[model samples]
Target: MLLDALVNTTDAVASTRSRLAKVEALAGLLAQLEPDEIAPAVGFLLGKPRQGRVGVGWRGLSAAMGAPAAESSLTIADLDALLDRLAEASGAGSAGDRSRELGEFTALATEREQDFITRALLGDMRTGALEGVLTDAVARAADRPGDVVRRAAMLSGDLGETARLALTGTAEELDAVGLVVGRPVLPMLAATAASTSAALETTGEASVEYKLDGARIQVHRAGDEIRVFTRSLADITHRVPEVVEVVRNLPVRDVILDGETLSLDEDGAPRPFQETMSRFGADAARETVLHPWFFDILHVDGRDLLDEPLSTRLAELERVAGAHRIPGEVTADPEVAERVSRDAIEAGQEGVVVKAIGSPYAAGRRGSSWIKVKPVHTFDLVVLASEWGYGRRKGWLSNLHLGALDPTGEFGEPGGYVMVGKTFKGLTDELLRWQTEYFPQIEVRSSAGTVWVAPTTVVEIAIDGVQRSSRYPGGIALRFARVKRYRDDKPASEADTIQTLRALLRE
Candidate 1:
């Protein structure tokens, strides 16, 4: 198929807000692809390339730019081959070679194709064709159930391959794609709850496990060979040999365990999250060893336990890795659940996760089967600046610059606020318009897309937690921040202190 056809379909998909329209457009495009082209076509439509990260940055792309071709002549096969060559380039003069190749390739693409290529290369396909929409499109085109398609995609951890199999192969073949011993599958995720009592009321007879403040690890072992993967399914077997050795020592011949890994202090308490991340990202650091704590098992021997309930999986985990299991219990009483949550917090852990006893594993997506309850801290913060919006939010003030009161003058001028992070989430159309109208009245300066305002307007913001950072002057940043409302009655001096946020990080 010609590359223009796919680009045109992507444009159509992005140009609409209706879910049905997007699915129809994607299904129509999928129907026209050949068997061998289905995988790459789906990848491109999803705003991803088969060859990952070809070392092409904005500077490289800008330097390689040439005038677009008057007509479209490039084929899907041709584009895929060019990307393959670019991904394979390395060593001496690789940057120049990549730039030359990108220039040659971009010169053959039309203007619309160039626009699509830029977004795809930048990993920002902003198209409405996200994973959920594309999965529905696949089901519609293949005459299969959405659940079946989702399971195949999650188990294989590759939507493009799943698309190809669903379109060209039989349903039985798709179902046969089970968990391999050394291959990584998408880990299950948890939903959030306001409190443990509410979570227990929703999911009766629940298992409340301590939510650790560490990185997620999925270990796959078969005899002496062992492989470890992160939550996003990145293979990191070489970085942590200690984890590999521990999994290799398990009694089971073949097993897949899902757990968390973190560094512990001399007192056996979990280290700071920043320290754990630093150790996790290191290529080789044998001095600081990471300990693994298993919570669930996905597979044991040749039996696949993914279809089993949480109780069954826990039993299998106890038999295989009882020594490394996290602390938890099964109960329906809200009082017990709250007690466990309290204990977890007292032990310097994050919080507790309440899970339904009979729910099977839902991979790659956050479902309500398992819910987490953590202490949410909200503070009155100052809005320093705002940025222009895009897409449906165009012509409006959207993303806000959030600051914490720095009273000690530790970072800069006396009584001046310090920037922690920026957030564009949890804003409705009314809030967007309100900011667009009210912010300029307090504006101190304006730029091309951003407006700087006096730090007099205080707004209430909620955050999951805080993390240590070097990018901001205060040395801390918020996680999953969202605006609750504008605190018009509060003064800048009454805003939350930088010390308060940094204290949360220490917890």
Candidate 2:
């Protein structure tokens, strides 16, 4: 199939608000693809390339200029092969080679194709379609159960391959994509609750485990061989030799364990999250030794425990990891759950995760089987600017750029605000409309898509916590920030200060 066909389908998908319409459009497009073309097409429509990052960034692509093709001639196979070659470029002067290759490819692409290619390269197509939406579309196109397709995609760790099998292969093939000892599957995620009592009220009998403030690691061990993957399934086995050694020493010969890895101080308290992240990505000279705490088991000694309940999985995890298992208690009592959560916080941990004992591992999706309760931090911040919205929010000013007061001139000018982060979450349509009309009234300047506003608007912002940052002037940024409401009565002078956020870095 031609690349033009897939690009047109993606355009149609982005032009609608109804999810069912998007699924129907994508499913119709999938039905028309050849068996071999389905995989690459699926990847492209979902704003990802099967070849992964092609060594091209916005600067590289925007710098290269070429005349567009008068007609569409690039095939899906042709583009995929070009990307494969681009991914292979490396070593001395590989940048020039990649630029040359990208220049040639761009010359053959029309203007519309160039737009699609840019979005695909940046991994932000804004098509309102992602893995979850495409999974449903694939199921509808292949006449298969969505649950079966989702499970296969999660286990195989490749949505493109799963779509290919569902479209061209049999049901047995989909079922065969089970747990493999050395391959990583998507980790189960948790929903949030106000407290342990609220979470226990939802799930009668639960396992309350301490939530670690560290990086997520999925370790797979077979004999002496072990592979460690991140939450996004990127293989980082070589980065942390300490993790490999720990997994290899486990009692079980073959197993897939889900856990968190972090560096602990001499007192056995978890370090700051930045310290853990620093050790996780270091290529050599691993100074800060990371310790892995096993929380759940997916496969143990050739036994597939994905379909089993949380109780059975925890039992297997305990037997396999023993002392390495995460500390937790099984109870239906609200008081016990509250005590456990409080103890976790006192130990320098994040919070507690209350999980349903009878819930199976629902990978890749954020189901309600698990609940996380954590303490929230809220502050009154000033809105520095706002960016124009996209898709459904095209006309309104969305995505607020937040800033905190700097009284001591620690970051730039005295008595000015320093940008901490940006957030578009927790904004309703009413708030969007209000900002659209109100922000420009106090606009300091307006540009292509952003409007710089006066620092008079104080807004209440909630965050998970703060993290060390090099991009922000205060050397810290808000983690998971969202708008609570506009603090209309407050002034920018009374807003929270950078010192307040820096204090969280110590905690």
Candidate 3:
């Protein structure tokens, strides 16, 4: 239950990819922990605190967190005492008394704990060590994949399910029920084609659809009540009130639809994702702002559409979703698919995710099943996990490693997978806090502060082209990889594969 114990394990899990093996390792370690340590243990690895970490941003807030336990205290326990005092202050204290009290507390806490608490409150621990990694460690201990554990964790809203499962054996019961996105159905794998002819040649029957640039959304509805979630299952119902209202007004009462929530300019061109996210913070977002475009329905009335193909869902989605239409459908013709991709790009959108008619909405699965072919304009890549960001980059995430799926092994891997390069750009003061908190979590095995992470984050890697490499994991290195915008829409597993990067070179 010591904070260090949990922190250490989190470091271990972030580096370990084998979820099943992690579970075994954690099971042994968890058995030694006390019951009281359970929630804190879970919370830490989960990338949060048991008592939601007390954060301090303002100098006043910083002062309170840094306040010493007493004249002689220096431990985190002392900081906790200082924070506890914040919750106990009386309003009767005049402004002068309040200022004095604040000053006293700030001076008492150690500089280290004070800074840590300050960033914690801000909630952007850019530390490569993140809760997702801890979730993976917990999942590994549970004999499932970290993602499987994360899906289950998100559903339960609890991470301690790991220890409980180890002792009681109920964790397996939950994992048995996969967190499906839409209708419960096995996901169909996708076929890759370097060109339109190549794509059509593989599928005996071919169909293509306009790949909108927006966050992939899956909705589950019953009557007027509906839950709008992201492909990752994060409840976005609150973030996209406009879409929720649209869902409530839909013609069908009971239905589940799949779609994208795009941010568009007056011309209907997709806006930058950051702009779309910023709008969510507006008071008007609740009144009216942002747009919802539904494209596929996985369930309608009382029937499930998993057995049905993408073609059937598109038709049904249009009918039930109303205004939500399949943007544009393309015939299986390779030349036509290419034309559509070009048009989407010229229209100022990111690129396209060419979905076949027979595909299923694969929940928690990333394959060619649903693919993203981005615009020639490379999206930005943020430095996620770095080794020292070092040398001149020391103390920063120096080397930028980028990832995206390679439906083809053009980059030479089984799938296109590669780590771009190190970057010294796109970092901010706030980002420094993030790296400080997060990088430690993802640190595979580190000495002092120097560390490494399993290349698991997707950075919009750009380049003149890729070249053979002996230093990087994907066998190729980016020419001049630097920080771009941080992406939350595209998950790490969904990052460009080495093969996909190869075509960029070929082009």
Candidate 4:
């Protein structure tokens, strides 16, 4: 397919607030696409090339333009390089003008250039928009599982392999076969039950494991090779050589285990999420102190135990893994798991994913399968147009703004659904860079260079809570609303309903 075709799909997806229509249009295109065209086509569909780890916004794109001509995976240094270029490109100096000229450079064809020119400036790579939504649009168009698309894209830095399978057949095909380099589809997540009775009501007969705050990772091994994937399903074997080294120590030749690659301090307790985040990209020296805490086992020696149920996987994982690899399994008792979660939080960990033993792995689905109970904090929201982040945060623009998801003078969209908030926190630097560049394409109106999006991104921010505000559009403000991370796995319809926030206010 022509790059223009994909770019048109992205333009519709990015501009219009109607996510379903965006998805339907893209899906129609995917139905007609060849497998080989999937990666670059989708890249165009997202309106930007996959710069890998250079960071997604202007910062990231700026760096790729100046990067040395070398074949390298995404790295933090790459982002810094991009940031340097972005600063120069946006500046008013002689070198800055040259950088701006570089910003206008394009490998796109003539027709493709016209469409992008009409969309936004500088190749329409403004952030404050959700790549996740665009990701969902692609998944929906291709008729593939959203997470599968995300994981594959994250894993291979290309979706050609999986997209080929999805277009030719079904999600099962992509799930059933692919190069081992790609990451596996992420399992869906469950919400935390506030009360014990609630927890019991939600998870009957299900065992619970400590909710670890450290990085959620999946370790897959085939033959003698090992690969580590983040919850997002991006392969980070090089980034986390330690995890790779640890998996190499596992006895089983072909096995897939789920766990946390916690960034530990000198004492061994889990480090803060920010500290752990500091290790993202590539940093061998800093990574030496990182630790991996094993949790779930999805596949054991090609058993495909995700369908066999969690209990069998756990037991087999323990027996096959022995004590040399994987973390010790804790009890199914909620109290025990809660204690573990508390310990993780107390030790500056993010929160834990309370999992039920014996449940089969539900790739790319979030429900009661595995629940995440983290400390609740509210963020001051600024409404950025609700669009998707990539991967799990595809639809609903779950990576939202915080000025408020509330009403503004009884105007637009029933309540306050305008683009007011923005964040790429909790997301890797690569994700952030993608958004920054993507934002301008869908720019609605607001600040000059900041590119005020349509105010649709309804992000779920983690902060202290509600506070008085006069500076923002919404009357109320988020206390510490920093983008915790993109809630890729959620739908906008399920975003923080007004009623939910009111209830919290009552509390």
Task: Please give the lDDT score for candidate 2.
Answer: 0.84
- Tens digits of per-residue lDDT, candidate 4, 218-329, equal 7888878787877656677777877777778877778777777667667767665556655755546463456776766766665566567667767776676556333323
User: CA shift at 301, candidate 3, in angstroms?
Assistant: 3.9
By TM-score, how accurate is candidate 1? 0.77
Candidate lDDT (C-alpha), each: 0.82, 0.84, 0.53, 0.52
Candidate 2 positional error at 237, Å: 0.7
Best by TM-score: 2
Lowest summed lDDT over 10 consecutive residues: which window, candidate 2?
Answer: 485-494
Root-mean-square deviation per candidate: 12.5, 12.4, 8.7, 10.3
lDDT score for residue 274 of model 2: 57
Per-residue lDDT tens digits of candidate 2, residues 1-507?
888998899888877666788899999999888988888888787657898778776567766647788889898888788889889999999989988988899899998998788777755465667577789999999999998999999998889999999999999988788888888887887766667998899988999999987778899998888999988688889988988988888888899999999999999999876578777878874678899999999988888998899999998888888789888899999999999999999999878999999999887656578988777667779998999999999999999999997755577544468999999999989889989988875565679999987676888788998999999999999999998767543345556789878877876
> Which stretches of candidate 3 lie above 4 Å from their native place?
1-4, 7-23, 30-43, 46-207, 226-239, 272-274, 286-288, 302-309, 375-380, 384-419, 422-464, 468-507
Q: Model 2, residue 45: displacement in angstroms?
A: 1.3
Q: In model 4, which regions exceed 4 Å deviation?
A: 1-4, 7-20, 32-35, 47-160, 168-183, 187-197, 320-351, 376-462, 466-507
TM-score of every prediction relative to native: 0.77, 0.77, 0.61, 0.62
Which pairs of residues clash in candidate 1, taking residues 3 or more apart in a chain or in different chains?
none
Worst 10 residues of 3 by lDDT: 183-192
CA error at residue 175 for candidate 3, angstroms: 6.6
